[model samples]
Target: MKRSIAQLKEWFRRGKYPTESQFRDWLESYVHKDETVPVSQVEDLPRLLNGKFSTSRGESVEREAAALRLKFDRHKEDADDEFEKIENNRQALVAEDERQQGEIDAQQAQINTATGQLETVRKLLHSGASWTTVKAAFDVLGGNYSSLWALANTVKTFLEASDTSDATINRWQELESFLQGITDTDSLTGLLETMKQEIGTAYLNDLRKTADELSGIPATYAELVERRARGGMLPGTLYRITDYETMVANDPEARSAGHPFDVVVMALDEHTLSERAWAMHSARDAAGYFGKSKLEAWQVWYCLDNDDTRFQWADTTRGKGVIYRLIDEWGNDCPYDFKNVQFKRCNTTGDFVDNVVDDADWPNTHYILSPSMNGQADMTADETDYKWLYTFTYLEQMQDVRDASLINEVNADFESAYYNKACNCNEMQAYYIGEFIDDTTFATQALNNIVLSSYDEENGAAVKMYGNKWGAGCFNMTFHEHCYGNSFGVNCYCLIGFKLYYNTFGNDCDGNTFGNGCWYNTFGNSCGGNTFGNDFYRNTFGNSCVGNTFGNYFQYNTFGNSCNGNTFGNYFRYNTFGNECYNNTFGNGCNYNTFGNDCDGNTFGNYFWYNTFGNECYNNTFGNDCDSNTFGNSCGGNTFGNYLQYITAGEGVKYLNVTGGSDVKHFVQNAHILNGTSGKDSKNLLTVGLPEMSTVCRYVGQNTAGVLKIWVPADLV
Candidate 1:
């Protein structure tokens, strides 16, 4: 009934096993009936069952099974040892990783602490700490001496680079001195306190003085009124009284004796008065300050209107007596007596007369009224009246009144009328005569409002005379001449001239002549002239020269504004706007160069050189030579020179003609012929005839003409 080992082996190969009930019954009945046997040993039961069914040659079934078990156990033991070793190694790696992470965290914490300390030290260094504090901290930290010195230098550099005041610099210098010494923190602190105290004390002292310095003088109205009323008179000081009422009240004896009060106030001291008080008092006392005799007739009326006590004497009197003594001396009637009469003064003689006086009666004097006295007349005079009747209404009108006797009489009359005898008699006479009258021939000549006149072979010629404004005249042999009102050529023959309103050659022309509004600036007997506008702005030599001529015999030279003249030349003739000709002749046998508005004339020869704009040229004759000239607006002249260059004129072929010897380049809008010739040979002529495009022509000598011309297209070449 038991299964053989061979049958069992067959069953195992064929994937067949015994039934659980059969196996259990067999184990209970034959192997062992003990339930204490471990079920883990059941795994070996199958191999034992296989061994029992096997046929071994030298061993039993039980021994074979046991040997197989021992081999399996050894393999299991080796795998377990390998797994244990792997687990131990994994645990050891995990501990090492944890330790490394702890070390990293501690290192990071130390670095953070160092960074915080460094930041703290930076703040202390930037805060302008004293040398004592820095040294103490350095010593405590055991810092290297070199590193501490470097840090101190760096801080010093930083502070110096910053915007430090003078006081801060001084404080830093003191700190440096202390650091050089063996000073402690306590000593440094004491020194700093002392410096602060001294600075504050000095600042307070400056502030007090500044307050006092800024304060100005303060005045009162009561003091001003008292000073004005007193007329600057001191107590018991004698003074004149012109007012009849005041004379009657203050000096009854003078009033009864038909005299004005000329006595002291007997109360206040004028010397003790304030400066402002004295000024106000002096202003009010017109008779004493301005002198009673020097007062004009109009001044008398003005004083009366202002309630001046000096003029009050006239108010108390009647008829002719009512007029102020100043008016009587001026040869003028009272304003109330002759309301219709126009009071006029002789500008040459200073004599007052009625407007009804004939012009011929005052031929020797300028019978004109000042602008201030013109208000006395009912109506203003016309030009004719200004010449004949009211001759000297303006200061310029007296320029040609050259009668010495008349001038003396006029001066005397003015002195008597205004009580103002001139301190310098010669100056007064010069003012009246206008020029030094050594010759008597100019005593009768008087030009009145004539625009142009020529006086030849006359001893004394008064070109602009008797209220001639805006007139021009010339004198040839006259010794004394006078011009007025933007006129030219006054006071010829060794007499000084006066010019006004941009007038050229207005006074004293020995051998020079200039036009109206032309500058008479000559050097070495040469005619260097300039024209100006309404504002009289001149063109300078080197800047914006319009029309100026230099050198001798410069004729018809027209420079635009302030053009410079020739330096050395005899005949710079017929130059129209030719400025700054250096030993050059312009025009036809005339040394002149015509430069356009704001152009310079640096021409060197007697040739007709006309430049429109800023053109610079050297010595060359014949056709219009515009070399290195920049044409801004239009170029309409014949240009020929060594290197005649033109730029931006017109877009066609008719405006500019640029003919030069060599290297003649033109970028103009339209050019007629760009002729670049080296010599007098047709073979060396480079002419570009491209009317539609701008061309650059050069002498290449490739062709028979020895020239190369490149034509660039209008759009692109």
Candidate 2:
């Protein structure tokens, strides 16, 4: 409402001023002063020498407001500067954030690349790829030391969880340490390859041998056959028969009269002959008689170097004769040639070659007869050196010839060195070649180290154990049979491997399986699934036993019978005793403590039936009257006696020396006193109740009265 002197000048000189009537109207809004003042007396404004001036509050108020506006403008300018400074700080913070974000993105990218590389290495290792292949892959995708370390630790954890052998784990640790300094892929590969070689047969199969070693070289026939049967031989293996004698000696099942020895597995062609280019030819002509049939003379002649067989004895004159081509046992081919040849028949029974008397006499020579003229030959020439020719004939008295019929017959009875016939002896089986021995007719002694042929259902090769009770010490024998009610009635020791079914064992057995629904009428060792009649040690008997009663120490027999009265030894696995097993006496650690089923009146040792058979009977003396007791290492489902008339001694009570109902008496210390009894209980090897607890205790059983007394240690003056 107030106006200054400057305002009055502006109103007088500039267009910002209103008209005089408008200014008087605006002045009407302010208070008027009575006296008039010169503009020169105004303060904080330019002094104006006006002609006349009326004093009013509008000038003062206007001057004061203009000064406040100037102060407000300066404050606003300072606030704008502060805002600019704040904005600059914000821009700087944003730039810093962007720089950090870039660094974070780069680190994240590296992390992703490392993670992918580790995953690739993990997959490659898991696939069992060779170390070389893995190294190649690692080279392709750069790997780090940390990734390899993580992979090693991961593999170690897997091995530990799998219960790998200690040596194997140690080897892995050694390999890890060996490669710890190297992170280069090629270096790791080289070190791993060296380690692999150092492991040797620990990783390699020992059965892989050289080709010649596996081939049946006359001595290794049995070993090769056994190895082949056990899947140790490579598939489609071919055995070489060096000669006829070797073939006959090694595999007698492959022998036949007159059957080509080398042609069984592979046929001998012209390439098999050493000098096939010579081109030999044979011609048959009428000859003498060998026995009942007439003999035909065979004239064989090999051509000369020209490769043509001229029968006129001109071009084919390398060797020509009515010669006997003889092959000896050592696979030697001998052709006897002369000017001419003739047959001399004789009724002798000796070697034909040994009788080389001049064509007039025949002494030890044997005449061979043939069905046709294909097999008879004799030299009538006076050759004194034809004495080694042995004759094979088809006569009943002579040695049977190696022919096709006999080979077929022998082959029909054998398969892979296992005889399929029913033999009445045990001589050959001792050597493990008699796989299908018919022991029903002849009882043999024990057998050892024999691997019985596996049962073949399709081929009816089921091995039958005899019914007669024979003592057979079968050690390290593997009996695999598709058990068809075959009982092993032989007493055997170390009857190792058996997967039988429905077979009974009648004699004492060890480590065998008496099959399902079979009764074991003998003492056994770790035998399973048989109804045992005799005392058993570590045997799990089958159901439905007949007349099975045991009295001696039944250590670990689990049979389904009434275990009424029986004693046991230590390591009693279960309290599963027999039904009707009352009045049973258990020694030391009988597990089935509570009277089994109906088992009563049984004396038990300490820790008899503890924490078993739903009975919390720990070291207590007795269990409840009639509870279902689990006979540990004994029968499963059989009623035992009741516990009514039995006083089970506690841990200390069993070995305690009980006196007459005296003043609370116990065999305490070295000296037995009446009431205030105390000394050193030196009954145990360690003497207690001494002045010093660490004093050595000596066992001097001076007190004869406390012989069966439990030593009660006490300290008194």
Off by over 4 Å in 2: 1-493, 496-645, 649-654, 658-717
Best prediction by TM-score: 1
List the lowest-lDDT window of 10 residues for candidate 1. Answer: 423-432
lDDT per residue (tens digit) for residues 1-717 in model 2: 556656656676745758876576456444345355654456634534433455666688788999999999999999999999999999999999999999999889877776667556545544556656755665654434344544555554554565678887897687566434444444444443443442333223323344444432222223433544465544334333222111111221112121112101111231121111111111111231112211122222221122112111111222211112222221222221111211222232222223211121323222321111112122122322221111111111223211110111223554653334211111111111122233423222211322222223344332332121223433332232211223343434333222233334444444332211222233323232221111233444433232232322333445433332343434334545444443444444455433334333344533344423311111112222322222222212121222311112211111112122111121111222121112223232222121111122212222444432223354311
Model 2 lDDT, residue 77, Cα: 100
- Give the per-residue Cα lDDT of candidate 2 at 397: 20
Q: How close is candidate 1 to the true structure, as a TM-score?
A: 0.23
Error at 109, model 2, angstroms: 83
Q: What is the lDDT of residue 324 in candidate 1?
A: 21
Q: In each prediction, how many residue pairs overlap at the backbone (N, C-alpha, C within less than 3 A)?
A: 41, 54
What is the TM-score of candidate 2?
0.18
